[model samples]
Target: MASQVPPQIFSRRRRIAGLRRARVRQAKRDAARYILDDMVEDVLDRLEFIRMSPTRVLVIGDWTGTLALSLRGGGSDVTEHDVATLDEEHPVESESYDLIVSLCSLDRVNDLPGALLHLRNALAEGGMMIASFLGAGSLVNLRRAMLAAEPDRPAARMHPLVDNQAASALMQRALFKRQVVDSRTLTASFGSLDRLVSDLRDQGLGSALANPPPALDKAAKARAGAAFLDTASDQGRVLEIFEILTLTGWKN
Candidate 1:
């Protein structure tokens, strides 16, 4: 059989643009940005709790530079590698770093298993790697709204996310020596659908699909808005949940 090529699920150009967009919006964070705040804070707390003090550290997808700065402040030499690439000559050099923390990037990768493998390859023996990203059970309201927008046949508007169990399986498949996976749910209230979309865009949650659906027309947009409104609570606020899946493991 001929070798099989991995289908393109995300556009590299779009992914980079999303990250850059998030970086620019970092200064004007809002309640929606609590996703990143919760993740980064968890990474820091885990490092402290585990008492793993590595001299060399690598951070990926840190739009705000907070995590890397904290690591540096703690006396760990830090490298902020924001570029997304996985190859033999990867900038992440094999067995180079003592610890690697990836945030909000893996979910956008075309080959998540391959990405995790590359991350593992870049770690020194017994080194640790922790990654966090938006996972399944997130954006249920947005999805429902999009479906209601196109009542007939719905087009794929967002990427499929990995749940906690799937994340754990991926880490195991990545051949991590020892791994643990868990998820956290962060919720925010929005008064309108447009506000929710704006918040997602501002926090690096924009569409990076290889074949995104065409822009919604006026009628569809109105329907989607109405659908989102249907989910609002008695207090007239829509509660949206962001499931952040975290995986922590050791390099064999």
Candidate 2:
């Protein structure tokens, strides 16, 4: 049996729809390409030093299909699953895969521990699992803008992120061997507040909170825009920081 997803944390439908839309836009736009590309590249580059090349691979959250294609191109047999299709109890045979990779989706999972356990169960002995997602300290400027819009009483809008330490703990709890968690920050610049929000949407960074804050009314939206603009650099561009956490482990 799988653990129950906590309703207080995320909305599955919204998260799914956001990724689906992102998949579509990614074919035509470059705005959201770097993050996913960078993650896959990092994993592959590290695999070189480890002296391992997984032959049977499972890739989750290949919304733009880049990661899966990259693996297949490198001669690995690949199985792909969009993250939205995976539930807490999604079946995977024990010792089924030599490698598993998930990018940018685990953060939105309502039953993260359960998901990690399943991934571990699917890995063959000595097999590796590597996953990455948005982490704590991300989006400082955007968070500030939202709060400024409703200074008196801010609502729950952004999804909370798991920091590096917590991520390591989760891997240990899931019984993955050689657990490791680390983070890196990537900075994205935008010409305007609205453009920043649009880029987020394009990248499937929509709110996954189960009870999302009410839509910003015109007045509030205007205020947020004004506040966001005030923080622009001398070049008249706003920068948003994305802290990406990576978790890695091997099945014993």
Candidate 3:
């Protein structure tokens, strides 16, 4: 007979699945507002080193396929791969792309390093990659609130967010040359706590926690609302942090 896994492990997996489903649902609902346009400008701003015109490009996790469309607008042949379901170990192809851009989507991937390697392989020797992803500094206030609400919980109520240092390390280890990494924190304010939560739902953020706290029951929801309201500023705005890191490297 196979050994039974601990209940906690099973619970954690279930929570992760629930979070993924919630994110997919949100993606379906808010695809237009949350996709390409939101991150493409930032990606382009950081891709200053790349020549304006490239022959072929590949985009991993083409959420809303905005990047692909943008590259096409710039007159490059573009191909897209949605890595969420495909075998991450084998992305698309090797040495085929002049540029590969990943935007705000790699944090949810299970094998981040492997994905990076696959991306590198997909690039020609001189090809460049410009990637932006959410960093660990994101959701500090929310994380603190959750921790305070459940001080004894072993795991975080949100997914494991990465920091700049960790992201840099991942990039450096990916065997790329001319590596440059930078991070920035964006603060978006909400008129009310409920709107903040709803915005997160709309953006498909924070939907991959291990053993996430159960959905807010009536009393729990009341408490959470009170807590966020207490933290509101005099201007009646509550802030949420989005820590984004941009990494650039070239295949040697």
Candidate 4:
């Protein structure tokens, strides 16, 4: 006789789904410090072209708040919002900003194009938006490992990744003028798979596997652990990839 579907599987599925939603939400609020701090600082350093004395500025996402804090410290008027809070019915006031900065948060948005348009609408003519986010190429190794572990599993509901070309194309379609887009992959290493997974949780990257495979029994967990261990290098290190896309454009 065929074995019954394990109750644990359903439980795991529900847990994973909840985790995914939580992570997506967390990504908006918690703002990973190491990533946000570095990326925001870099964007600020490159803001020489943008007028320094803008009377009103909008910062979207937490990293944007970090940028706003810096700009305010330098004496710029700054207000902030979480992108998730913005929508058609409750739009940001029209033409309210001289500058808008969004950092490392757009990819989690359900409507990237719409958000760009809203950002454009919120800006005064000649205002600029500088945004950075993790694109399609992020997290290749973890994705591969997950697939390797469960080749028959169903596809993910949320986007687990984004690529550079796709991100650039989306920005182009948004009609921002003379858009500047650049992307680069940053690799972080972990001493073991467990630590790697832990770091992902800490960074709010665990949300992608919204419906991870059901919890394996002790034997299965051991087997998967062995498989990963076998694939590890002599130093027992595993690599996680973060592909960051940076873009700047003006609302003409």
Candidate 1, lDDT over the whole model: 0.85
Q: Name the lDDT value of residue 86 in candidate 1.
A: 32
**Span of 10 residues, lowest total lDDT, candidate 3:** 6-15
**What's the TM-score of each model vs. the native?**
0.93, 0.92, 0.79, 0.74
Tens digits of per-residue lDDT for model 3, 77-194 = 9877554444444565457788888765667666677667878888887888888777788776666655555445424456776777787788878888888888777787766556
Comparing candidate 1 with candidate 4, which one achieves the higher TM-score? 1
Model 1 alpha-carbon miss at residue 93, Å: 2.4
1 or 3, greater by TM-score? 1
Per-residue error for 191 in candidate 2, Å, reads 1.8
Worst 10 residues of 4 by lDDT: 6-15
How do the residues 1-252 of candidate 4 rate in per-residue lDDT, one tens digit apiece? 994432221222433443355456545554334666667777777775554566788776552256777888877888776534443213567586878887655665545666677777778887888887777777666555554454566344235445666766767787788788887777877665566655555454454333354654565445445555555677886666777888778888
The candidate scoring highest on TM-score is 1
lDDT of 1 by residue, 1-252 (tens): 996666888887887787678768766735357777788999999999999888999888777789988888899998886644432113356467899998888888777888888889889988999999999989999999999999998899989999988888989998997799988888888999999988887778899999998999999999999999997889889998888889999986
Candidate 2 runs further than 4 Å off: 1-7, 88-94
Candidate lDDT scores, in order, read: 0.85, 0.82, 0.66, 0.62
Candidate 1 Cα deviation (angstroms), residue 211: 0.9
Order of models, best lDDT first: 1, 2, 3, 4
Q: What's the CA error at residue 206 for candidate 1, in Å?
A: 0.2
After superposition, which runs of candidate 1 have C-alpha atoms over 4 Å from their true positions?
27-32, 84-91
State the lDDT at 183 in candidate 3: 78
Number of clashes recorded per candidate: 0, 0, 1, 4
| lDDT score for residue 62 of model 2 | 62
Model 3's lDDT to the true fold?
0.66
Which of candidates 2 and 4 is the stronger one according to TM-score? 2
